[model samples]
Target: MKTLIILLFFSIISIASAHAQSNTPAKAEQEIIKLSKTKWDWMADKNVDSLSTLFDEKAVFVHMGGSWGKEREIAVIKSGSIHYKKADIHSVSVNIIGNTAILLNNITLLAVVGGNEVSNPFIVTEVYVKQGKGWKMGSLSFTKINQPAQ
Candidate 1:
């Protein structure tokens, strides 16, 4: 009888663990969403310190003009070469697979590039990799939308 009770207790714990694991994706989605929004804020403010920490050392950034790595991206922001004035996000979606999160943002971005202000609609893809207890952005690619209307 005591052995049966022990077995039942372990079974209960096992089921509980499985249930918790099932809910992990939803929680991870929210975390990624919040982190992405915060990243936008950092970009708009040109807060390179926060952005540098959030971005992976080998992170890649793709823009309409060209693509570059993390250091160049940070330098551009610091120099006001590409000032991310604002990002009007229309929609966002996140997918989590293992230790990777891919986020898509539909936004109308207003920015200053080479001292010229421009607003463009873009679908931005951001890939983040979970490292230990922290998440770092691995890639940011922007695809321009042809249609003007949001």
Candidate 2:
């Protein structure tokens, strides 16, 4: 019985993964894209409460200057240390792998850091994991782009 149960679970996982890899962007892909866009708005507004709910407990955030976990990220936003003024997204793409989603956004971000306003192009990568009925952000990483935004 135990062996059979394990095999069944693996089969389910295999089916889920295969389904997620389909070329057509399905509802799940749309959902992830929308979630990522909303996340930008939350950051711009400094809505730590909403962001806190979206981010997983073990979420990791990576920036040009440093990298930190969820708690520190919330603290930083709440303290107004790095104010996300706006994000002008050029393009966005998402790939769902089983219960995990990887989203990429090419954007030009306007932010106030250390009381100085700056704008920079970045390729932001967001990883989300579906837990229960909702998705939680597991990682957010920003990679600066030297070229102009397309």
Candidate 3:
């Protein structure tokens, strides 16, 4: 009877541990999606303050036409050279690797650059690291989708 009780207790502990581990990735992914949407909203409105909160201290951004470190990216947002009129994220995929997450998504940005109108479609990949209390964007790389404009 003692052995049976001990076995059942161990089984329950194992089951609980497994369930907790399984939910962690899902929770992390959801947080990442939320972050992405927040970024899009901030960009659409040229909200520098909001965008600043999403980036890590050491984030790196490889934009379609250029690359920028965290400081420069923040400066760009502050400068407000290009206003994001609309941003559409078509699909998103998330992969958890240890304490890091990789997010892939297809995006469309409608904006004007130097008074020239443009609609940019891009394939974006971002790596996020779980910080002490939340996830911070570590790196972001994007490539322009090369199809003739309709």
lDDT of each: 0.95, 0.94, 0.81
User: What is the per-residue lDDT of model 3 for residues 16-50, given as tens digits with 9 covering 90 to 100?
Assistant: 99999999889999999888888878877777776
Error of 2 at 2 (Å): 39
Off by over 4 Å in 1: none
What does each candidate score in C-alpha RMSD?
A: 1.3, 7.1, 2.2
**Cα miss at 28, model 1 (Å)?**
1.1
lDDT of 1 by residue, 16-79 (tens): 9999999999989999999999998999999999999999999999999999999999999999
How do the predictions measure up, each by TM-score?
0.94, 0.84, 0.89
RMSD of 1: 1.3
The order of the candidates by TM-score, greatest first, is 1, 3, 2
RMSD of 2: 7.1
Tell me how many clashing residue pairs each candidate has.
0, 0, 0
Deviation (Å) of 87 in candidate 2:
0.3
TM-score for predicted model 1 compared with the true structure? 0.94
Q: Which structure is stronger by lDDT: 2 or 3?
A: 2
